[model samples]
Target: MPHVEKAVKDWQQQFAGLKTSAANLMQIAFPPLEIMQSPTGCCETRLHWQDQDSEASGYVCIDDFVQATLQFENVPHSVAGQALDEVFGLGWFNGAELGVRQAGEGVYYWTDETNAAEWEVSVLPGGLANLSIEYTNAPDIATLLDALHTAYEDPHEDDAAT
Candidate 1:
Protein backbone atom coordinates (compact mmCIF):
# COMPACT_ATOMS: atom_id res chain seq x y z
CA MET A 1 0.00 0.00 0.00
CA PRO A 2 1.28 3.51 -0.89
CA HIS A 3 1.12 6.08 1.88
CA VAL A 4 2.18 9.72 2.34
CA GLU A 5 1.56 11.85 5.39
CA LYS A 6 2.77 15.39 6.03
CA ALA A 7 3.41 16.66 9.53
CA VAL A 8 2.55 20.11 10.89
CA LYS A 9 4.10 22.95 8.94
CA ASP A 10 4.20 26.73 8.92
CA TRP A 11 0.97 28.69 8.58
CA GLN A 12 2.07 30.43 5.40
CA GLN A 13 1.51 27.22 3.40
CA GLN A 14 -2.21 27.26 4.14
CA PHE A 15 -3.67 27.60 0.65
CA ALA A 16 -7.38 28.21 0.13
CA GLY A 17 -7.29 28.11 -3.66
CA LEU A 18 -6.60 24.40 -3.86
CA LYS A 19 -9.22 23.64 -1.22
CA THR A 20 -11.74 25.78 -3.08
CA SER A 21 -10.97 23.94 -6.27
CA ALA A 22 -11.58 20.63 -4.54
CA ALA A 23 -14.90 21.86 -3.19
CA ASN A 24 -15.88 23.13 -6.61
CA LEU A 25 -14.98 19.89 -8.28
CA MET A 26 -17.12 17.99 -5.77
CA GLN A 27 -20.17 20.11 -6.56
CA ILE A 28 -19.71 19.56 -10.25
CA ALA A 29 -19.31 15.84 -9.76
CA PHE A 30 -22.04 15.13 -7.22
CA PRO A 31 -25.75 15.72 -7.29
CA PRO A 32 -27.59 18.15 -5.03
CA LEU A 33 -25.67 17.87 -1.74
CA GLU A 34 -25.64 19.33 1.73
CA ILE A 35 -22.19 20.44 2.87
CA MET A 36 -21.04 21.31 6.35
CA GLN A 37 -17.87 22.33 8.15
CA SER A 38 -16.65 20.81 11.39
CA PRO A 39 -15.46 22.79 14.39
CA THR A 40 -12.11 21.13 13.86
CA GLY A 41 -11.85 22.80 10.41
CA CYS A 42 -12.72 19.81 8.24
CA CYS A 43 -15.28 20.21 5.41
CA GLU A 44 -17.79 17.41 5.01
CA THR A 45 -20.89 16.60 2.99
CA ARG A 46 -23.90 15.03 4.58
CA LEU A 47 -24.76 11.55 3.39
CA HIS A 48 -26.25 11.82 -0.11
CA TRP A 49 -28.47 9.14 -1.46
CA GLN A 50 -30.10 7.96 -4.66
CA ASP A 51 -32.79 5.91 -3.00
CA GLN A 52 -34.16 6.68 0.43
CA ASP A 53 -32.52 3.70 2.07
CA SER A 54 -28.97 4.01 0.77
CA GLU A 55 -26.72 6.85 1.99
CA ALA A 56 -23.29 8.25 1.20
CA SER A 57 -20.97 11.04 2.22
CA GLY A 58 -17.73 12.77 1.14
CA TYR A 59 -15.06 14.94 2.74
CA VAL A 60 -12.32 17.49 2.02
CA CYS A 61 -9.65 18.70 4.42
CA ILE A 62 -7.20 21.58 4.37
CA ASP A 63 -4.59 22.56 6.94
CA ASP A 64 -1.39 23.60 5.20
CA PHE A 65 -2.83 22.81 1.78
CA VAL A 66 -5.73 21.02 0.11
CA GLN A 67 -6.36 17.30 0.39
CA ALA A 68 -9.52 15.93 -1.18
CA THR A 69 -11.11 12.66 -0.06
CA LEU A 70 -13.64 10.83 -2.23
CA GLN A 71 -15.89 8.15 -0.77
CA PHE A 72 -19.26 6.58 -1.58
CA GLU A 73 -21.22 4.31 0.75
CA ASN A 74 -24.18 1.92 1.05
CA VAL A 75 -23.44 0.21 -2.21
CA PRO A 76 -24.71 -3.37 -2.10
CA HIS A 77 -21.44 -5.06 -1.26
CA SER A 78 -21.99 -8.16 -3.39
CA VAL A 79 -23.67 -7.16 -6.63
CA ALA A 80 -22.39 -3.64 -6.72
CA GLY A 81 -18.84 -4.66 -6.04
CA GLN A 82 -18.97 -7.32 -8.73
CA ALA A 83 -20.32 -4.78 -11.16
CA LEU A 84 -17.51 -2.40 -10.28
CA ASP A 85 -14.95 -5.15 -10.68
CA GLU A 86 -16.27 -5.62 -14.19
CA VAL A 87 -16.77 -1.94 -14.91
CA PHE A 88 -13.46 -0.73 -13.48
CA GLY A 89 -11.54 -3.84 -14.48
CA LEU A 90 -9.98 -4.31 -11.06
CA GLY A 91 -10.27 -6.81 -8.28
CA TRP A 92 -12.78 -5.85 -5.62
CA PHE A 93 -12.08 -5.36 -1.91
CA ASN A 94 -14.41 -6.84 0.74
CA GLY A 95 -13.59 -4.40 3.61
CA ALA A 96 -11.32 -6.85 5.44
CA GLU A 97 -7.87 -6.48 3.88
CA LEU A 98 -6.40 -3.26 2.46
CA GLY A 99 -6.02 -2.55 -1.22
CA VAL A 100 -4.20 0.35 -2.81
CA ARG A 101 -4.01 1.80 -6.29
CA GLN A 102 -2.68 4.93 -8.00
CA ALA A 103 -3.93 7.29 -10.67
CA GLY A 104 -4.11 11.08 -10.57
CA GLU A 105 -3.52 10.56 -6.83
CA GLY A 106 -2.91 7.65 -4.54
CA VAL A 107 -5.96 5.70 -3.35
CA TYR A 108 -6.30 3.13 -0.59
CA TYR A 109 -9.13 0.62 -0.38
CA TRP A 110 -10.27 -1.09 2.83
CA THR A 111 -12.41 -4.21 2.57
CA ASP A 112 -12.47 -7.98 2.62
CA GLU A 113 -9.93 -9.01 0.03
CA THR A 114 -10.92 -12.63 0.50
CA ASN A 115 -14.28 -12.40 -1.24
CA ALA A 116 -13.22 -12.18 -4.85
CA ALA A 117 -16.80 -11.76 -6.04
CA GLU A 118 -18.08 -9.74 -3.12
CA TRP A 119 -15.64 -6.81 -3.66
CA GLU A 120 -14.88 -4.02 -1.18
CA VAL A 121 -17.41 -4.19 1.62
CA SER A 122 -17.85 -2.54 5.00
CA VAL A 123 -20.28 -4.42 7.16
CA LEU A 124 -22.31 -1.78 8.88
CA PRO A 125 -24.35 -2.26 12.03
CA GLY A 126 -27.12 -4.88 11.86
CA GLY A 127 -25.20 -6.80 9.20
CA LEU A 128 -25.89 -4.37 6.40
CA ALA A 129 -23.04 -4.55 3.91
CA ASN A 130 -21.67 -1.54 2.06
CA LEU A 131 -18.87 -0.61 -0.29
CA SER A 132 -16.72 2.49 0.11
CA ILE A 133 -13.75 3.87 -1.79
CA GLU A 134 -11.43 6.73 -0.83
CA TYR A 135 -9.05 8.53 -3.11
CA THR A 136 -7.39 11.91 -3.55
CA ASN A 137 -7.04 11.96 -7.33
CA ALA A 138 -7.75 9.31 -9.92
CA PRO A 139 -8.36 8.98 -13.64
CA ASP A 140 -11.60 7.00 -13.25
CA ILE A 141 -12.92 9.54 -10.77
CA ALA A 142 -14.74 11.61 -13.40
CA THR A 143 -16.51 8.68 -14.95
CA LEU A 144 -17.46 7.23 -11.58
CA LEU A 145 -18.69 10.60 -10.38
CA ASP A 146 -20.84 11.06 -13.44
CA ALA A 147 -22.37 7.64 -12.97
CA LEU A 148 -23.12 8.44 -9.34
CA HIS A 149 -24.69 11.76 -10.31
CA THR A 150 -26.96 10.04 -12.74
CA ALA A 151 -28.02 7.54 -10.14
CA TYR A 152 -28.69 10.25 -7.60
CA GLU A 153 -30.63 12.44 -10.00
CA ASP A 154 -32.85 9.73 -11.39
CA PRO A 155 -36.45 10.27 -10.41
CA HIS A 156 -37.88 7.65 -8.10
CA GLU A 157 -41.45 6.41 -7.86
CA ASP A 158 -41.85 7.79 -4.35
CA ASP A 159 -40.51 11.18 -5.42
CA ALA A 160 -42.80 11.35 -8.44
CA ALA A 161 -45.87 10.71 -6.33
CA THR A 162 -45.03 13.51 -3.98
Candidate 2:
Protein backbone atom coordinates (compact mmCIF):
# COMPACT_ATOMS: atom_id res chain seq x y z
CA MET A 1 0.00 0.00 0.00
CA PRO A 2 1.13 3.57 -0.63
CA HIS A 3 2.37 5.57 2.31
CA VAL A 4 -0.92 6.78 3.76
CA GLU A 5 0.78 9.60 5.62
CA LYS A 6 2.32 10.93 2.44
CA ALA A 7 -0.99 10.54 0.65
CA VAL A 8 -2.71 12.58 3.34
CA LYS A 9 -0.07 15.29 3.08
CA ASP A 10 -0.42 15.30 -0.69
CA TRP A 11 -4.16 15.70 -0.32
CA GLN A 12 -3.62 18.54 2.11
CA GLN A 13 -1.31 20.31 -0.33
CA GLN A 14 -3.89 19.89 -3.08
CA PHE A 15 -6.55 21.62 -0.96
CA ALA A 16 -4.53 24.20 0.95
CA GLY A 17 -6.85 26.99 -0.24
CA LEU A 18 -9.65 25.65 1.95
CA LYS A 19 -7.46 26.89 4.80
CA THR A 20 -7.41 23.38 6.16
CA SER A 21 -4.34 23.44 8.27
CA ALA A 22 -2.38 20.27 8.92
CA ALA A 23 -3.66 20.38 12.48
CA ASN A 24 -7.31 20.30 11.41
CA LEU A 25 -6.75 17.68 8.72
CA MET A 26 -4.88 15.45 11.15
CA GLN A 27 -7.83 15.45 13.53
CA ILE A 28 -9.69 12.93 11.35
CA ALA A 29 -8.54 9.48 10.37
CA PHE A 30 -6.25 9.49 7.34
CA PRO A 31 -6.85 7.65 4.06
CA PRO A 32 -10.31 6.60 5.21
CA LEU A 33 -10.04 2.88 4.44
CA GLU A 34 -13.13 0.82 3.78
CA ILE A 35 -14.11 -1.36 6.71
CA MET A 36 -17.08 -3.27 5.36
CA GLN A 37 -19.44 -3.76 2.46
CA SER A 38 -23.00 -4.58 3.40
CA PRO A 39 -25.13 -7.19 1.64
CA THR A 40 -26.91 -4.37 -0.15
CA GLY A 41 -23.49 -3.17 -1.36
CA CYS A 42 -23.27 -0.13 0.88
CA CYS A 43 -19.73 0.67 2.07
CA GLU A 44 -18.72 2.21 5.36
CA THR A 45 -15.56 3.72 6.78
CA ARG A 46 -15.16 4.15 10.51
CA LEU A 47 -13.50 7.32 11.82
CA HIS A 48 -12.28 7.22 15.38
CA TRP A 49 -11.81 10.40 17.34
CA GLN A 50 -11.71 11.63 20.91
CA ASP A 51 -14.23 14.35 21.60
CA GLN A 52 -12.29 17.38 22.73
CA ASP A 53 -15.36 19.09 24.16
CA SER A 54 -15.19 17.72 27.67
CA GLU A 55 -18.59 19.24 28.42
CA ALA A 56 -20.20 16.76 26.06
CA SER A 57 -21.72 13.67 27.57
CA GLY A 58 -20.16 11.14 25.25
CA TYR A 59 -16.86 9.40 25.96
CA VAL A 60 -15.43 7.94 22.77
CA CYS A 61 -16.75 9.31 19.50
CA ILE A 62 -17.04 7.26 16.35
CA ASP A 63 -18.21 8.67 13.04
CA ASP A 64 -19.44 6.45 10.26
CA PHE A 65 -18.73 7.71 6.78
CA VAL A 66 -21.24 5.82 4.73
CA GLN A 67 -21.64 5.67 0.95
CA ALA A 68 -25.03 4.62 -0.36
CA THR A 69 -27.16 5.17 -3.47
CA LEU A 70 -27.30 8.59 -5.04
CA GLN A 71 -30.07 10.79 -3.62
CA PHE A 72 -30.90 13.13 -6.50
CA GLU A 73 -32.67 11.08 -9.11
CA ASN A 74 -34.44 14.12 -10.49
CA VAL A 75 -31.12 15.42 -11.84
CA PRO A 76 -30.84 14.42 -15.45
CA HIS A 77 -28.48 11.51 -16.12
CA SER A 78 -27.11 13.38 -19.11
CA VAL A 79 -25.50 15.86 -16.75
CA ALA A 80 -23.93 13.38 -14.33
CA GLY A 81 -23.23 10.36 -16.50
CA GLN A 82 -20.25 11.51 -18.51
CA ALA A 83 -18.84 13.62 -15.75
CA LEU A 84 -18.94 10.72 -13.31
CA ASP A 85 -17.15 8.36 -15.65
CA GLU A 86 -14.52 10.88 -16.56
CA VAL A 87 -13.75 11.79 -13.00
CA PHE A 88 -14.12 8.43 -11.27
CA GLY A 89 -13.75 5.69 -13.85
CA LEU A 90 -15.61 3.32 -16.14
CA GLY A 91 -17.68 0.37 -14.74
CA TRP A 92 -18.46 2.43 -11.68
CA PHE A 93 -22.15 3.11 -12.17
CA ASN A 94 -24.09 5.81 -10.42
CA GLY A 95 -25.39 3.72 -7.56
CA ALA A 96 -26.97 6.46 -5.51
CA GLU A 97 -28.61 9.75 -6.32
CA LEU A 98 -26.61 12.85 -5.30
CA GLY A 99 -27.75 15.28 -2.63
CA VAL A 100 -26.42 17.41 0.25
CA ARG A 101 -27.31 17.36 3.92
CA GLN A 102 -26.16 18.90 7.16
CA ALA A 103 -25.16 16.21 9.61
CA GLY A 104 -23.96 17.09 13.07
CA GLU A 105 -21.54 20.03 13.01
CA GLY A 106 -20.50 19.50 9.41
CA VAL A 107 -21.94 18.52 6.04
CA TYR A 108 -21.64 15.03 4.55
CA TYR A 109 -21.59 13.75 1.00
CA TRP A 110 -24.39 11.28 0.42
CA THR A 111 -25.66 9.11 -2.39
CA ASP A 112 -28.86 7.12 -2.97
CA GLU A 113 -27.26 3.81 -3.96
CA THR A 114 -25.05 1.31 -2.17
CA ASN A 115 -22.08 2.42 -4.29
CA ALA A 116 -21.85 5.64 -6.23
CA ALA A 117 -19.94 8.90 -6.49
CA GLU A 118 -21.33 12.36 -5.74
CA TRP A 119 -20.13 15.79 -6.86
CA GLU A 120 -21.52 18.96 -5.40
CA VAL A 121 -20.42 22.59 -5.68
CA SER A 122 -22.16 25.25 -3.65
CA VAL A 123 -21.58 28.29 -1.51
CA LEU A 124 -20.80 27.20 2.02
CA PRO A 125 -21.95 28.93 5.18
CA GLY A 126 -18.95 31.28 4.99
CA GLY A 127 -19.79 32.28 1.38
CA LEU A 128 -16.98 30.19 -0.08
CA ALA A 129 -18.08 27.90 -2.85
CA ASN A 130 -17.65 24.48 -1.29
CA LEU A 131 -16.76 22.02 -3.99
CA SER A 132 -16.84 18.39 -2.88
CA ILE A 133 -15.41 15.46 -4.76
CA GLU A 134 -16.10 12.05 -3.24
CA TYR A 135 -14.89 8.64 -4.31
CA THR A 136 -14.33 5.15 -2.86
CA ASN A 137 -10.97 6.30 -1.63
CA ALA A 138 -10.41 9.29 0.59
CA PRO A 139 -12.27 12.29 -0.84
CA ASP A 140 -9.71 14.96 -1.72
CA ILE A 141 -11.59 17.85 -0.14
CA ALA A 142 -8.51 20.07 0.11
CA THR A 143 -7.55 19.65 -3.52
CA LEU A 144 -11.02 20.63 -4.63
CA LEU A 145 -10.92 23.78 -2.54
CA ASP A 146 -7.53 24.80 -3.87
CA ALA A 147 -8.59 24.28 -7.47
CA LEU A 148 -11.80 26.23 -6.97
CA HIS A 149 -10.01 29.08 -5.27
CA THR A 150 -7.39 29.31 -7.98
CA ALA A 151 -10.06 29.24 -10.66
CA TYR A 152 -12.17 31.97 -9.07
CA GLU A 153 -9.49 34.33 -7.76
CA ASP A 154 -9.25 37.69 -9.49
CA PRO A 155 -6.59 37.39 -12.21
CA HIS A 156 -6.02 41.04 -12.95
CA GLU A 157 -2.92 42.34 -11.24
CA ASP A 158 -3.22 45.96 -10.03
CA ASP A 159 -1.55 48.02 -12.75
CA ALA A 160 -2.72 51.58 -12.05
CA ALA A 161 -0.07 53.00 -14.41
CA THR A 162 -1.54 51.05 -17.39
lDDT digits (tens) for residues 73-103 of candidate 1: 5543333333343345443432322221211
Q: For candidate 2, which ten residues in a row score worst on lDDT?
A: 54-63
| Colliding pairs, model 1 | 93-119, 93-120, 94-111, 94-112, 94-121, 95-111, 95-112, 96-111, 96-112, 105-137
lDDT of 2 by residue, 1-162 (tens): 479989999976665533233213323422221223233232222222221332111011112332211122221122223233234343332232331211111233344254354654332333222324344223343232233223223222231111
TM-score of each: 0.45, 0.22
Error of 2 at 53 (Å): 32
Show model 1 residue runs off by greater than 4 Å: 1-14, 38-65, 76-87, 90-120, 123-129, 138-143, 153-162
Candidate 1 versus the native: TM-score?
Answer: 0.45
lDDT for 103 in candidate 2 is 13
Give Cα-based local distance difference scores for all models. Answer: 0.39, 0.29
Residue 101 error for model 1, in Å?
A: 19
Q: Total backbone clashes of model 1?
A: 10
Root-mean-square deviation (CA) per prediction: 11.4, 16.0
